[model samples]
Target: MIIERKQYKLLEKIIFEKLVIQAPFKIPNPMPDEACFLYMLEGQINYKTENQNVSVPQNESVLLKCGNYFSQIKNDKSATLHQIIIVHFHPKILKSIYSSDLPEIFKKPSFIDDKIDLSHINNDFLIQKYIENLMFYFDNPTLVNDDILILKFKEIILLLCQTKNASTIQQILSQLFSPTSFTFKEIIENNLYSNFSLVEFANLANLSLSSFKREFKKNYSDTPANYIRNKKLEKSTELLALSEERITDIAFDCGFKNLANFSHLFNAKYNCSPSLYRLNLKDK
Candidate 1:
């Protein structure tokens, strides 16, 4: 089934909370501004993405990028899972905390590497306690202090890094910084329909525009504009399949200037016009 992209909530720019999820639930694909860390408190979770599938058991944590597609299948019918403390923050929040020395891992999107498992990390008890405290604060929002909350978050990440392989840290950082270099699967799943200039995107990564463009091309073998346009076309196809919206409206909503330009790009990218694509989808 084709899924429509939902506008992300820009909640507080930096916010932390606890998540308790039941089994057999699917998490819809996230928007670019939302990222999360899942630390399993009890039971087992089978997580699937386009490129990989991972089974996370109790006391294990998985870091998910905003662009990644993930769904969970519960292993036990009676099992209950607690995602300890989830910290959702924008890139700007990290910049304010780390300044220019922001760790490279935070720059790019990555699944925490296999070599770096949180289950074996020391201070698991401490981490659990930290989460408990945060949850308490969440329950009592009136007494929450931003400074203390941010400090606790920094401590949690620092400790996780200390327990992980050094190389994994570097790779994660690189991925966070260069979103344009994201894997082809990620490119398709991320729903990059919003039009953004190279300069604007580079600024998000704290990189000079020219340097960002150079690195982007080197990694993805496509210019940012072309990549974004192609992604929009892909989304337009899904919208055509699932919605009764007129092709021209869908084109403009997806960032095309006009129907002619949208049809031309769609044909170039998919070798079919929008109406024909929808017709084929209906036939299927």
Candidate 2:
């Protein structure tokens, strides 16, 4: 439950926001084209990305890149009420802020790193002081003006550059200016065996579910379900024939949910149980 919410805008863009809420808070964003710096002033939160989930503790903060995100309150029995402040960085805002002089930090790096989209920032002395100073304006909302807000925004960027995670933050911020896109086939081949649903795959591809299905059909000439299942089964058979691992492990590695389902599907496709199939391969 949201007890209270306050926000300050820059040219009608939400530049900063504060929220006070009760437990059971959940936010599922399909995609975000801007970066955010979030501070947990009162309680913990679990922010999940495609690759990992992070537990953000009270008084700490995190810097997240532009990507899909799911966030929920990390419950503490004694504390049901939580407070948080988020500072947003939109491409247009960055461009407006640095129109006269672009910072070295925003320049493209010589080498790019892996596509890990989350960076946890521990609220050290400098950052903690910055947060405290900003809260004063939040307390006396009238004291805040556009110039002050812009200065504060610039202040945080400099502070982030000073932090040990500056390189990672640089990479994240760079993406805001120069966004990257993945090829459709590259997206499919990379995530085909993982546990992501079709909708999630569509979100990753930046396409609607219907369009994703259409593209899948156009490129592969088969439904996503049929193609992925057959591919998984093919890998499972190779594992069964070559490896001495447990069938359950092989099933999971190849992306089936459970042994019974794997056996049933294998039987349906091959007309033979996995156990018998393995035995026949061993005998041969």
What lDDT does the true structure give each of the candidates? Answer: 0.58, 0.80
Clashes of each: 10, 0
Highest lDDT, which number? 2
- Return the top candidate by TM-score: 2
Per-residue lDDT tens digits for candidate 2, residues 145-246, read 999999999998999889899888887888888765567887777555554678987987888999999999999999998998998889899999999977
Each candidate structure's TM-score, on Cα atoms with residue i matched to residue i, is 0.50, 0.63
lDDT (tens digit, per residue) of candidate 1 on 91-184 = 6666677776776456543454534322222236656676666666666766656676677768766755665543454443344444434443
Superposed model 2: Cα runs more than 4 Å off:
28-31, 76-79, 181-284
Candidate 2 structure, TM-score to reference: 0.63
lDDT of 2: 0.80
